[model samples]
Target: MRTEGDTWDIVSSVGMTALFVAAIRAAETKQPDALVHDEFAALFVAAAGDPDTNRLIDDPELWADSPLGLGFMGLRSKFFDDHFRAATEAGVRQAVILAAGLDARAYRLDWPQGMVVYEIDQPKVLEFKGQVLADAHATPTADRREVAVDLRDNWPAALIEEGFDPARPTVWSAEGLLPYLPGAAQDALFARIDQLSAPGSSLATDTFGSDVDFQQLADFQTEQMRDTSFGKIDIADLLYTDDRSDPAEWLTKQGWTTKAAPPEELAARYDRPLTEVLEPYAQMFNGMKYLTAVKPS
Candidate 1:
């Protein structure tokens, strides 16, 4: 369940989803034909001390049973990785990752000189990531800064206080984030981004497909996880499935040129079919869309 003033660390509530993502990334890293590689992923999972997630990572059969496993996360990571690369390659040096949970892009990507990457998440989430990476003696390829604040709060002010510049062109990513926010908050989030974005800024995000039956999907997934080592706590409780604006349509109305890639396009482009998802879930997953938008200079 969610509330207006709720807060959580990496091990509970919405935060545990980050650990799950990291575990998937760790699994993806081990694949011979992996789409994206993040060496720090396994380190985060190992440090978390979650025996069940560790089992999921280690046991091939268990990983195979996951609804969204290595193949899906690999393609998802590749899509966002390409987004960042293209943005930076086009000379946008400033980047902000919204709700950046256990994403090691700062450490793994070969960023250009003078690149600054801002990761915004909860204080404890950031703290856990920082401590884990620090203990592993990992170094980021870019100038990395952590803005420890919840996206549901006044994160724009916090980000600006941490040296974000609204005047400069910025590239922002909201991967696996929108579903966790209420419909109204989702709109407000992008509105805040629009206000802060300079002309020519770019944004990338993922959203539920038009054909999704949110309640049904949530119920199905919750039932599947009920007997898992995760206990009664499931991420379904944290997700918001209310009606919301299409990010591409909404951004276009706000003066951005938007491009959307459906799941088939992404699958074909990457040659990475989501082989792990069950048939029913895969049909649902097929409707998921990845979108990119750019404000005209």
Candidate 2:
């Protein structure tokens, strides 16, 4: 279990999750009908220096047991890609990516001129990402700033110190982040985001459902992880299965207009319906709703 002061780079624990997602994105990018293309994803995975993780990136059969999980990662990536793009197009010039892992959005996405992308995460994680991207000679599409701090700390203060313009309309995203935080911490995160948001600011997040059997799902995830090349590192250990409030409902109560959609709806919209093997996993995965909300102007 990760403690309050526990720190990780891009190759272990919570950091590994980032590399895992990047591997999946790398795989999805090679697909003919890819929903999103993250060109730098594979580079980050290769730089992780873990043989098993690198094997997972190179071998298709390594993820064969979790087809739905793979597909959902692709879908989730595209969903957030669109969400950030929409926010930028809507004139929100400042964007914050909470718990920004190895996400290369600041480097890969086309940002509006003069836009600023603030990446908030642990210092080491940000350092590793910067080094790898720098080694690859990659440059950000926006004026990118790295706010190196843990979520449980005074991150808003750190963000502000890094020149974050909270008074200006900002777009904030907490992708693949909620489950790692305890119930109380999740609530506190949104409260902090709400406190910083200006009128016309928006927030997007993906969270697990309150109704799902988390124990059963965690067990299944453990089994699947063990069966793959990346099996030695149990992804389940990084998750905090404590009961958390519904994000969409909570956002609405906070006076924001919100919309929530399951992976099935998003899959259908993208014309990539789930297969039979993917059905049960889809049900479990669908429990995670992709939510987007706008604060009243």
Candidate 3:
């Protein structure tokens, strides 16, 4: 059964954070040519029903010129674009997106031939998303698979039973899922992935945003959660057991050779022009470090 906390997790997470990714993609597509799949953003929003899931979706003015928001989104897009590209180039035919929510990459991105993408999330979430996509008549570009299961459950066993290949290199992305899981659960989750993944497997995920002083977001979100009938669930309470100084450092303990990159460097690599100097607040939070780790082959 899905708890109110779980549902609120979906509510608070959608728009405020996505503003960055969506806007960057929106701006990029306006160019004569762009990188990766520009259309993925629209399909993702249509499938997710931005307003239906995210409370702030109706208020467009909240993030006018939001550098912090865009920075975060830009980071995510660049990370995913790099990881997925590497997965295909490395001959990885299997990919898994945990707590897939309303992500539309399965329908938008051009996956390598024979690649199968499995998305795992709740039944209702997946059901609503499939219905929305069907209504939109959106066509998927990859060999798409949807597995409706709570991340805390025996999803690894279920996935293996469903024919997930342990021998082949798999591209695994955790994205926004970690914030919703308890710390112990997060540990177990990584352990399961490690057990299931073979050498040469790559993992990419966003760590906690520095700005989330989580207490403030918790106080404000608590009131909003209660008002929405989602209850007074503290996000910080339900997830994140190990807060690390370096996400890459922690992964190294798991036998992954890791590299951490700050946002400023990433912008340069993507050829995005640097405008104003970054605000201390924005650079500290949301403008987090991203880490990529690979299991030894």
Best-fitting candidate, measured by lDDT? Answer: 1
Whole-structure CA lDDT of model 3: 0.63
Give the per-residue lDDT of model 2 (tens digit) for 68-184.
Answer: 344777788888998899988988899999999989999889999999999999899999999999999998999999999989878999999989887899999999999888788
Could you tell which candidate, 1 or 3, scores higher by lDDT?
1
User: Tens digits of per-residue lDDT for model 1 on 41-145?
Assistant: 888888988887777577645545555653778888999999999999999999999999899999999999999999999999999999999999999999999
Q: Give one digit per residue, the lDDT tens place, for model 3 in 1-297.
A: 224436422334332233324434544444443544455455545444444323322332343334422444545666776887798898888999887765677777778789888888777667766776787788877788888777878898778777788888888988766666765677777888788889889888876553456555555545544432223345445545345334566668889887767666777787765456433334334556666789988
Model 2 residue pairs with clashes: none
lDDT of each: 0.85, 0.82, 0.63
Give stretches of model 3 more than 4 Å off: 1-40, 43-61, 65-71, 209-212, 217-247, 273-280, 283-287
What's the TM-score of each model vs. the native? 0.94, 0.94, 0.75
Give the per-residue Cα lDDT of candidate 1 at 166: 98
lDDT, residue 88, model 3 = 80
